[model samples]
Target: MIAAVSGGSKDPQAGGGDGREPITAAAVAAQVGGVLVGDGSIEVRGIAPLDRAGPNELSFLSHLRYGQWFATSRAGVVLISPELAELAGTPSTRIVVAKPVDAMVALLARFHRKEPRAQGVHSSAVIANDVRLGEGVTIDPFVVIGEGVVIGDGSWISAHAMIGAGSVLGRDVRVHSTAVVYPFTELGDRVTLHAGARVGREGFGFVPQANGVVRIPHAGRCILEHDVEVGANSCIDRGSVDDTIIGAGTKIDNLVQIAHNVRVGRGCFLASQAGVAGSTRIGDGVQIGGQVGIGGHVTIGAKANLAGGAGVIGNVPAGETWSGYPARAHRDHLRASAAIARLAKIVRPLEQLVSKPFSSSDGESRANSRADSRADSAPDESGT
Candidate 1:
């Protein structure tokens, strides 16, 4: 177990005790090739939200909604896109970039801990016989490598991770703390498995037999191509016959569940808690929002985006954005929502009209009778 650092320390700079030179905003701007619009010599100790940043903190502006805060933020420096540079006003230094959020992400990675493993393998690690390890591999404490496992060069396996027999990990791959890769799973170069990620797990396949329901044997593999990253606690099940494949540059967020025989294409982004049922084929550049559930045997075409909480039951064509429970087109869903809202406004009036004791003609007659009665009740001083 990794020892927890005590938070009781009063010193703000206590986190960095190595005596290394502190990173300044100018240094970050230089690294990302962004031009500094204000004082480049200012030293920013930490990064914070735009609204909560202090004098020693760095904040970012990427959206128009935060433009108001950017003008008044106490941050020492602000990273902003070229489009939002005017909003920063005077005084505050701005690092202008084409993509401010991406630049901010690069800066965060530079400041944060990049790798969990120490420089070398731990003393308590267990390596099985006939395991092949490449150069510059770092295995943390209590990690277990099964027999015939092959780890490529420049890979880092975090503490307490288990690599099953005959599994192959490519170069520069990172298996985070407590993550498990089952036997026969293959990972391409630069793959990242976050903490508690499970690869090549048994699929939910069952066959109803005469006597009882029998679990189907998962005899296939799970393959993650280059640059694939599995988020924390996400699970990728092994195939029933063929390999369940995750294409290059695919990113899956936390709590995602990918069932057996699912084929995910290149550059796909699956958000948190998104689930793809068995045998679903997701095309390239598809974006799945958080908590979206795709039914089994479905096919989502390239560039299709499913909005949050969408339930997809059928096939989706290319370049469409869908949302809502049944998952219709985004514009159609918005139109339906607007229609419902308008209906809500008129519903009370319709209800009152339907429940009224008198019709329109009866109302007119009553109005005329009241007018005649008021005339009769009036004084006859002006009468002929």
Candidate 2:
């Protein structure tokens, strides 16, 4: 049921310059192993949200919250989860799957744009006499390969990238444009340093002295294990004494800062703008949300989750969810927040009472009125 949509160079195939073939609803269903329903003949050329999808585009519904946009969607083909299958929708073509988002991701991998492979070293690249390059390496223009550097097979050093002296890059490593790999750094296989990423940079360490501050020299290496990807503009500082290591399969988002001597474990995900101070140890499978700041020398247990904007100053237990400033257990943080809100309500009336100006006359009047009311309510000495 594969259909071909006629187009020029605008729609290139994944990993190739060939024009993308038009995909039909039936083809998508087959690719995701989804149960096809309604019209299998519908052609899907692009992907979009349910509300924004057109007749030539595909859409997905993974969560019930987004089901609000389902009925009115003009999408030609809809890939939906089983739970959302019962919901009525306008799209005539449907692909029912266990995970609609996963299905969509698979389709995106098939059609998404990929960087064109650049083979051979550019004439403008400066390679040191002792630098060793493996088979099928691509060194783009303005790239500088320092002495004693070893670039493994199929590695790509993008334009303006600088590999410092004695650095080692494994097979299929990608150093994007403007990325700087400092001296003696080790990047494992399939490691990707995005544009402007600074790896193995000297850490911020200084000893305060009476005369002046003495900068501590960093002599340790920065090591990124296999499949670790550092996002654009992220900075990974080299250690002062111990090696700074990022474990295999860790994905760091843009603008992240990993300070000196920090050890991040395998399969950890660090969101954008997250900063881990020096000497911190993060266990495997940890998830750090955006803008989270971790203090120095702290240890985060494996599988611990840090909520967005959390200020972590202490260790987090494994598998626990932490949030709020001076991060604590998620439940405790919520309870503390609720208590503060309740306390605020209690304090408001007292605040108002204390804020009012006091007058002697008003107090005396109130006292007299209370006395009169008591007298009226009091029983007479004689029988009434």
Candidate 3:
């Protein structure tokens, strides 16, 4: 029942100039243990979204909100959750699995193969005499290594990356292109600093003097524990007195800002555009949604979840969910939102009643006019 969905010649073996191997649906089923609902012999060359998948591409449907895409998608082959396979009654091949997104990720690793980089220092890299580079370190073009810096073995410093003086990076670390590592910063093994990530920058700390604000010197370092991954364009500031620490296995999303003296615990996931102000302590396994702003000196307990755009001004208890601006408990937020919605209905009628003016020829107005005339005829401040 499998059919080609796109307006292209079926070429499952097709690939770009790189060495990405094509895989058949039978192989994919064997790899991810998905139940094939159609022909298993069809070959899939690449992976993409449902709308953008070509004839030889494998697509996925995970979120129900994207069902419109599924209803109209022309993907040649698709992966669906086992529970939703009946909803996808298309002519294309379907692989039913428990998690469609996870399967698609696996297919991505297969199709978009990483290019092998050579292990050596590029000629354009500037290395100081006191710099210690371990075996198998790959320094790309124009990389600047300062004095007394130690880069561990099997690490890759990409093009234009600057490792400042007295910084230490552990084994298998990857500092991507244009990433800046400030002095005295410490990164553990397998840490990844993605493109344009600024580590150990000066924190935002100032004192109000008689004349103006005086800037405090950022003296302490920033420590990213083992297996940490900082996304592109994120900034981790150095502490004013104590170290700003990112615990092991934490993955930060793009455009995040971790301020001075903030301690983020292990395995925490911070979504894109999230910010933690200075001196905040986030417990382990906390999940922070996109664009969430955490105030300074707040402590979030372990496994707490902060929803998107939440402004957390105080401590959050462990295993609780917080939402809304100036975040509160999840149930409280829900009740408050419901109350506001109900009040909106009640307020609309009152607003209309207040806006309407009194009738021009009303009986009440006539009575008031007669009373004013009587008062004018009867009374005066002085005897006439």
Which numbered prediction scores highest in TM-score against the true structure?
A: 2
Model 1 stretches with alpha carbons more than 4 Å out? 1-20, 23-38, 81-90, 96-98, 345-384
> Please, what is the whole-model Cα lDDT of each candidate in the order they appear?
0.87, 0.91, 0.88
Candidate 2 vs. true structure, TM-score: 0.87
- Positional deviation of residue 152's Cα in model 3 after best superposition, in angstroms: 1.3
Please, what is the TM-score per model?
0.81, 0.87, 0.82
Compared with the true structure, what per-residue lDDT tens digits does model 1 show for residues 1-384?
Answer: 333332232344533222234677788789888989878888777678787777767778889997777767887878888887887343378888888888777767544533334556678899897999898888888999999999999898988999999999999999999999999899999999999999998899999999999999999899999999999999999999877999999999999999999999999999999999999999999999999999999999999999999999999999999998899899999999999999999999999999988679998999999999999888897763
Clashes of each: 0, 1, 0
Worst 10-residue lDDT window for candidate 3 reads: 1-10
Error of 1 at 381 (Å): 55
Per-residue accuracy of model 2 over 41-72 as CA lDDT, tens digit each? 88777788888888878889988888779989
- Model 3 per-residue lDDT tens digits across residues 1-384: 112222223344554212445788888887888998888888777777777667677888877887878887867678898777878435368888999888877767666645456678878889999999898888888999999999999898988999999999999999999999999899999999999999999999999999999999999989999999999999999999999999999999999999999999999999999999999999999999999999999999999999999999999999999999879998999999999999999998999998987786776889899999998899576876
At residue 112, candidate 3 shows an lDDT of 60
Q: Compare the candidates by lDDT and give the number of the best one.
A: 2
RMSD of each: 8.4, 6.3, 9.3
